[model samples]
Target chain A: MKFFSLLFFIIGIQFASMAQTPESPAIVFGPVFGDSKLQELTYYKINDIDSVQFTALKFYISGVELIHQYKTVWKEANSYHLVDAFQEQSLSLPLNVPTKLKYDRIKFNIGIDSTTSVSGAMGGDLDPTKGMYWAWQSGYINFKVEGKSNLCKTRNTEFQYHLGGYRFPYNNLQSIFMDMPASQLHVVLDLKKLITEMPLTQKHHIMSPGNEAMLMMERVINCLSIKK
Target chain B: MKYRIIIVILVCILLSAFHMATEQLFVAPENWPETTYDFSKNPLTLQKVELGRKLFYDPILSKNNSISCASCHSQYSAFTHVDHDLSHGIEDRIGTRNSPTLMNLAWHKSFMWDGAINHLDVQALGPISHPDEMGEKIENVVLKLQQSKKYPALFYKAFKDSLITGEHLLKSISQFMLTLVCSNTKYDSVMRKQTQFTTQERNGYMLFQKNCGSCHTEPLFTNLEFENNGLAVDPTLNDSGRMKVTGNKKDSLKFKVPTLRNIEFSYPYMHDGRFKRLSDVLKHYTSSVLQSPTLSAHLQTPVVLSSNEKVDLTAFLLTLSDKSFLFNPKYSFSK
Candidate 1:
């Protein structure tokens, strides 16, 4: 009987180890995609835009520090994940930390990591197979922006913004922080503000990180000032 | 008097709980150090372990329902791809790097050839939606798994819910992988004095410490740091290792220090699966280190290994092959 109990105890312990999950929090920091009018097509030329297509649009957001009552509770160590709203079906940012304690403010950066990009075949946010990560060319998509527009010529253009540079002054990982009450743990990004002032022509198909991806990502993230 | 009585009751309860927990938690192997992974956050359970095993064998974890983790990482091959230079994914798409063997992964602070993935639980998402790999989204994969006949019950058993979130999927896989402890190698036997290395293997062991021991350290067989072991860049692939992530040009040509355990079988070797044999790897190390700013200091001087020494080194690497693990029914595919 004692031997049987010992066997049962060993089995019980083994079962317990299997249930432990790492505390990586996944939060939806996505578009306020409700009742927004869809726009048209056009070429946004390289030097400001003649016409271009935007098939997908997304970029990195990192350096997120969560605060409660102006005191930081938790902040991501190295949080720069590509949040592509255009191509990806849903935007769920899973944070890697123990979230047993509640958080009020969730601050993060908006760009890809130089380390994450070079690392081969990452599993989560940095999965290279996503095409979000360039194949041996650069590294992480740093930022990915795509959408089709109607400026002229082609009806739709496939614009892919793959921004990332490990070579000297080309680093574009952006830091972004947010303040919010625990109850109002909502992050809303408006697409219209990111692309343009209003009537978006097919001139804003920006992909990859450069002046366009950098400027556009800055605008998109900045436009995301807390809805106080 | 009442306070003292309450304190005594609390002490008794706490003592009993602590005793049970100590028996429950793994007492580390004698003389072996602490594990990097903190198990207190998520306690192990039999139901969860069984659920994890089921998930490990299931293809529902992948995007296409065609390729699973087991597709690239086979148990027979030390949880590494057997023959491929580069790992092939769904639709026969080729990836940039070779799959590393998965054993004693709990000691690994980071994963992948460049040490990109810090945690183990969320590592599966890399393969699931990679365009050259699964090419499907996690949301869609979750939907598929949620709708599947096998997963709901498995998820419930693992997490007490069948909601089938990505978090649950990743965690289950981590659970299965963490259980893969490879401490029964011949090297381990020699350490325990159960068996001694043959003269050739013993010679090879000494040579290994002299040549490869710094990066492929003893006990766990890795220092867990990235290094440039001096492989000339493939003109076609042109991978710059850790430099791509840091954006610092200094880390160019650096790759994660791969474990030499089971090094006999888990080849075609290196990140891109360039070298087919251990001799070729040694030859490259001894003679062909490309001059780079990021070259590891250990490989600065040429390793003077005679042809006989190469044979001895190969013999030592072979001792790491734990046949029992390769054929372990506990880790193999099951329903």
Candidate 2:
């Protein structure tokens, strides 16, 4: 009788432990629009500006908040990550969450944090492995814009727009909110429009962060399309 | 001349929707802390990582495909080239600093002894394009990977497409590197309470905590911060460490703190590989640290140790050796 009771106690504990652990959520991010003809995220129509096929899209969601409807509700600030096309790999944000680890609402910064640029190698979206990191220059390509235009002085212009500055005069990370329920959310990126519509000059290859990096990065995700 | 044009062409072709590639999983070790990498944005799969590993070990990354990352970053010696102080890349070329050991990379916030490269996924591009290293163009590397027979299938499996572009190739290498975790040493066992430290090791551990543990932290054996441990600059190398990247006058001679875990095997210590033995390293810490504007406050005062203290610190460092990781078959040649 004593042995059976011990086994039952162990089994009971295992069940409780399993119930406490939360399932990892799926994270998917990519270009939401493939071409200009495919509608954009904002109210604006897709068109070429000044004869440049400028695709107006948004990715810089300055903030992403994680809200947990389960357990006791909580929240975190600046959770949305920077998305770069030329130098960075597609992002995969981890979602394995507990109600406390996540909140019913998730708040995140859209551009690179001022602290991260100077602090050194950051993991994930900040890791140099993503290729957007600049070793010689001490900042991230917060906003990466690369495309060709026949109308510019150069036959085809490849513009590299890296916008970021942690110090005064160049902080580009922005904030945006989502009506995503207190539950899990999915953020998609349609990269197709990014390359198709943009005023690019071959002379401008943005490898580092600056006003150009910030302004261009903001424009890319300014009106990012999302679904709950 | 041709290289510049190809970069332009790739920039244009990449804009096409059909050219976009998928990302794959770059999973972290179980029970380990959450990884800094965001794999969902660039999902993890088998193809890209294996290609990266193959590319890492292959000679093709160099100008002549003569010296691969494995040339300097061997699996043995904790992936650091042990023969020379400064790294050698292509055509017997000499780099300015020692090639740092490569392991537990997923957790590391920076790369190179000076914390030069910030991310692991993009770190390879440095060597591939470094003048004295691989000396190849990123666009050319893409062309080479695209031409490989085994890589096309590998790319498709990882990214769901047959194309092997630079982004896909670079991402694949990042995947393999992310899997290179090294945390199974005897020291880790002690932390987990699975075993006890030997008398010598115990004494050594105490000495380390007192002396070197602050900079060479535990769990990872490195704080992953840049510090001027105070070695005078080598005129020939003229390396500026973090200052070169940040342009801050206060950040001179500050190299990234290296992990002391595999110090026993990875000889020729420091960013410049100036010391050959632990004794020299000890002596430098005790007496040779050159006072500079950016010198770490910890080493501001001399580190005085007795002869016995030196031996104990060395012994404690040995416990960081994880044989399984150093000789793991998975990390070795694919064959």
User: Per-residue lDDT for B5-97 in model 1, tens only?
Assistant: 999999999999877754432334446656876565455665666677777777776666788888899998899997899998888899998
DockQ of candidate model 1: 0.06
Task: Name the lDDT value of residue A39 in candidate 1.
Answer: 26
Off by over 4 Å in 1: A1-146, A151-155, A160-193, A196-215, A221-228, B1-29
lDDT of the candidates, in the order given: 0.69, 0.66
In model 1, what lDDT does residue B204 have?
95
Single out the weakest 10-residue window by summed lDDT for candidate 2 chain A: A36-45
Tens digit per residue, CA lDDT, model 2, B24-127: 12334445665666655555555556766787898877779899889998888998988999998788889888998887777887777666565665677688
CAPRI class of candidate 1 = incorrect
Q: Mind giving the per-residue lDDT tens digits that candidate 1 earns over A108-157?
A: 66666665544333445554434465432445666665555444233443
